[model samples]
Each structure stands twice: as C-alpha cells, then as structure tokens.
Target chain A: EPEVTQTPSHQVTQMGQEVILRCVPISNHLYFYWYRQILGQKVEFLVSFYNNEISEKSEIFDDQFSVERPDGSNFTLKIRSTKLEDSAMYFCASSEIADTQYFGPGTRLTVL
Target chain B: GESVGLHLPTLSVQEGDNSIINCAYSNSASDYFIWYKQESGKGPQFIIDIRSNMDKRQGQRVTVLLNKTVKHLSLQIAATQPGDSAVYFCAETPITDKLIFGTGTRLQVFP
Candidate 1:
C-alpha cells in the first residue's frame, strides 16, 4: 500500500533558528494537512493545504508557520523561528478527498 | 470549544480477548469519525471510519460504533492479540478536512 513519507525523521534546531519539515504525500492525494502532538497531549491541527494554497489553519498556525507544495509530490512546513514550545512531533497527512487522511511516520522536532 | 476525548487513559486485556475503546465528542456538527492506532514512535494508522449517516461500520477485525444522539464513539477489536497493543485515538471532523483527535487510550494486550 502506498503511504505518506516524511524526510528528516528527527530534527534538532537551536531556538530562534528555522526548520523545514518535508513530506511526500501519497501520489494521488490532493488534500494535505499538518498536525502536531506535544508530548502526552492530543494531536492538534495546524493547517490544511489544497490546490497549492492554504485552505484552513488553526490558531496555532500563526505567522511563523507556512506550508508549501513546491512540487507535485513534496509538501513542506516551515517554521520561521523555532521556540522551545514548538518542539513536538509534526505529522503530515493526505487524502484523495476530504476524508480518511493517511498519516506519515512524523518528524520529531526538537528545539533547544 | 470543540473537543474529542477518550473515556479511559489506559486499558489492559489478555490475548484472545476482545477490547472496546470509547470516545466522546462535544461537537454535534462533526459528521465524520475515524479510529487510528499508533504504536510507539510511529504515526497514526487508520483502523476504521464511520460517517454520521451510519451508526456502525466494520473492517477486518475491528468494528466502530457511533451514537450521534449521545455524541459517543467506540472501537471494538475482536480477538485481540499482543500485536494489538498500541495507543488508540478517535478523531472527528465537522465538515472540514482537519481532524480533531482525542487524548488517546493506551491498549495493552498481554499474552
């Protein structure tokens, strides 16, 4: 079965630095999403992308966060400046339609 | 103020037994619900899903029951095995693409 894949399984960055988490969604999927889970917390939605544009975003998806579908298969989430609280497991998910999204293994972001 | 939450934080079951994980949602507009299993260090894996139009759906060894009146959902795993040990989460969507996940329930299946 085809699955969503993410690069840099684990990332470590200094506070105030930038980090880009990359994901290659299932080839045929059109809707992509980013979610984060703090340790011992529930997963929270960040943003959703469709048609190469942001369809919706949550309050946590502030100016520091941006998502881009630079290519057909590559979808990336960039944090302009990392904060200690921003450290969490970031997951990329995609679906052929608006339902049943498939999730990637996730990228663990650690900011010190 | 919408939230999806699990009723239990952890559950233990013996192998060959059945497991039922419960979830409750405060959003009445949520029309879609999904159950996902996440092993340690891995992402959430799709187990099964049920739409509001339906009350029950089954897939493989799992069955999902949704009660819109009570705004509750449950995932039933039949004949649980040691491999079934994982954290189970129930997510809901209110006509949008983004899923609101629950706190998650850790299932421990022992042999």
Candidate 2:
C-alpha cells in the first residue's frame, strides 16, 4: 500500500532558529494536512493544504508557521522561529478525497 | 470547544478477552470519523472508519460503532493480544476536512 513519507525522521534545532519539516503525501492524494502532538498530549491540527493553498489552519498556526507545496510531490512546513513549545511530533496526512486520511510516520522536532 | 473525547482514559484486558474503547464528539457537522492506533514511537495508524450514514463498520478483528444521535463512537477489539497494547485515538472531521483528534485511551493487554 502506498503511504505518506516524511524526511528527517528526527531533528534538533536551537531555540530561535528556523526549521522546516518535509512530507510527500500519497501520490494521488489531493488534500494534505499537518498535525502536531506534544508529549503526553493529544494531536492538534495545524493546517490543511489543497490546490497548493492553505484551506484551513488552527490558532497555533500563527504567522510564524507556513506550509508550501513547492513541488507537486513535496509538502513542507516551515517555522520561521522555533520556540521550545514547538518541539513535538509533527505528522503529515493526506487523502484522495475528503474521507479517509493516511498518515506518515512523523518527524520528531526537538528545540532546545 | 467542540472536540472528540473518550469516556475512559485507559483500559486493561486479558489477552483473549474483548476490549472496547469509546469516544465522544461534539461536532454535529462532522461527517467522517476515524479510529487510529499509535504505538509508542510511531504515528497514528488508521484502524477503521465509519461515515455518518453508517452506524457500524467491521474490519478483521476490529469493529467501529457510530451513534450519530448520541454523537458517540466506539472501537471494539476482539481477542485482544499483547501486541494490541497502544494508545487509541478517535478523530472527527467536518466539511473543512481538518481532523480534530481526541485524547487517546491507552489499552493494555496482559498475557
């Protein structure tokens, strides 16, 4: 079965630095999403991308956060300035339509 | 805030017994519901899903029950095994399509 894939399984960055998490959703998928889960916390929605534009976002997806599908296959989330609280497991998911969502293994971001 | 939640935070069951994990969602506009299982270090893995039109869906040894009137969802695992130990989460999505996840329930199966 085809699955979503993410790069840099784990990352360590200094506070105030910039970080970008990358993901390649299932090839035929039309909708892609980003989510984060803090340690011992529930996963929270960050943003959703469709047609190379942001369809929706959460409060946590402030100005500091941006998502880009620079290429037809790559979806990237960039944090202009990393805060300690930004450290979490970031997941990328995609669906062909609006129903079932397939998730990637996730990228663990650690900001110190 | 409208969100998906679980009635129990954890459940313990014997290896051969059946286990049920429950979740409650507050959004009436939600048309899609999914059950996911997350291991200690992996991402949420899709187990089963039920659309608003359906009340029940079964997959392998797992079954998903949806009660639209009550806006509740439950996942039942039959013959629970030690490998079933993990955190299970229920997520709901509205027409906008962004998934709102619930606080997961940790299921422990003792052999």
Candidate 3:
C-alpha cells in the first residue's frame, strides 16, 4: 500500500536554530496535515494544508511555524527559531478526501 | 474541557486471547472516531474507524464499538498475537477533519 514518507528520520538542533521537516504525502491525496507528539504526551495537531494553503491550525502552530507545499509532492514545515519545548516527534498525514488521515513514520526532532 | 482518554494505560494478554481497549470521549459533536496502533519508533497506523451514526464496525480481527449516549468507544482484537503488541490510541474529530487524540494504551502480548 502507498504510504506517506518523511525525510530525516531523526534530527538534532540547538536552541534558537532553524529546522525544516519534510514530508511527501501519498501522491493522489488532496489534504495534508502535521501533528506532533511530545515524549510522553498525546499527539497534537499542528496544521492542515490543502490547495497550497492552510485550512486550520492550532495554538502550537504559532508565528515560528510555517508550512509550504513548495512543489507538487513535497510538504515542508519550517520553524523559524526553535525552542526546547519544540522538540518532539513530528508526523505527516494525508487523505484522499477530508477524513481518515493516514500517518507517516514520524521525524524525531531533538533540541538542545 | 472535552477530551478523548482511555480507562487503562496498559494491558497484557496471552497469544490467542482476545483483547479489548476502551476509550471515552467527551465531545458530543464528535461524529468521527478512529483507532490507531503505533509500534515502537513509528507513527500511528490506522486500524479501524466508526462514525457516530453507527454503533459498531468490524474489520479483519478488529471491531470498534461506539456509544454516543455515554460517549464511549472500544476496540476489540480477536486472537491477539505478539505482533499486536503496541500502543493504541483513540482519536476524535468533531467539526473539521482535525483529529484530537487521546492518551495511548500500551498493549503487551505474551506468547
């Protein structure tokens, strides 16, 4: 079965540095989303993208966070400046319609 | 104040035994519910889903039961195997497609 794929399975960055997490959702899917899981916390929604624009976002997706579908296949989440609390497992998901989002193996972001 | 949560944090079962994981969601408007399994070092994998309009839905060896009156959801696994051991999460989607996930339940299957 086709699945969502993410790059840089694991990343380590210093506080105040910039980071970009990349995802390639299923080719035919129209909607894409980003979620994060703190080490021992529930997975939290970050943002949803459709038609090259953000549909909805959470408080965690503040000024530092931005998502771009630079091309047809790539969805990128960039953090302008990272904070220690920003370290978490970031997952990308996609769906053909609006529901039943399928998730990708997450990218573990570590900030020191 | 509305959230999705599980009654148990961990469950253990023997191979070939049936396992049931239970969840309670507080959002009345949540019509879409899904169960996901996450193995170590991986993301959540979709298992099954149930809409509020239905009471139960089954797939393979898994079944999902929803009780809108009490706002409860449960996932039942038949003939549980070692590979079935993972952290299971229940998620609720109220208005939009944005999913709000619950604290996961870790399942351990012994052979």
Taking all chains together, the TM-score of candidate 3 against the true structure is 0.99
Reference-based TM-score of each model:
0.99, 0.97, 0.99
Question: Tens digits of per-residue lDDT for model 3 on B60-101?
Answer: 999999999999999999999999999999999989999999
Which parts of model 2 have CA positions greater than 4 angstroms off?
none
Candidate 2 chain A: worst-modelled 10 consecutive residues by lDDT: A97-106
Model 3 RMSD, rounded to 1 decimal: 0.6
Q: Candidate 3, which segments miss by more than 4 Å at Cα?
A: none
The candidate, 2 or 3, that scores higher on DockQ is 3
Interface RMSD of 1: 0.5
Give the alpha carbon lDDT tens digit for every residue of A13-109 in model 2.
Answer: 9999999999999999999999999999999999998897899999999999999999889999999999999999999999999678889999999
Off by over 4 Å in 1: none
Candidate 3: docking tier: high
Rank ordering of all candidates by lDDT, starting from the highest: 3, 1, 2
Candidate 1, residues B1-111, lDDT tens digits: the string is 799999999999999999999999999999999999999989999999999999999999999999999999999999999999999999999878799999999999988
* Order of candidate numbers by DockQ, starting with the best: 3, 1, 2
DockQ of each: 0.93, 0.89, 0.94
| Model 2: lDDT of residue A89 | 98
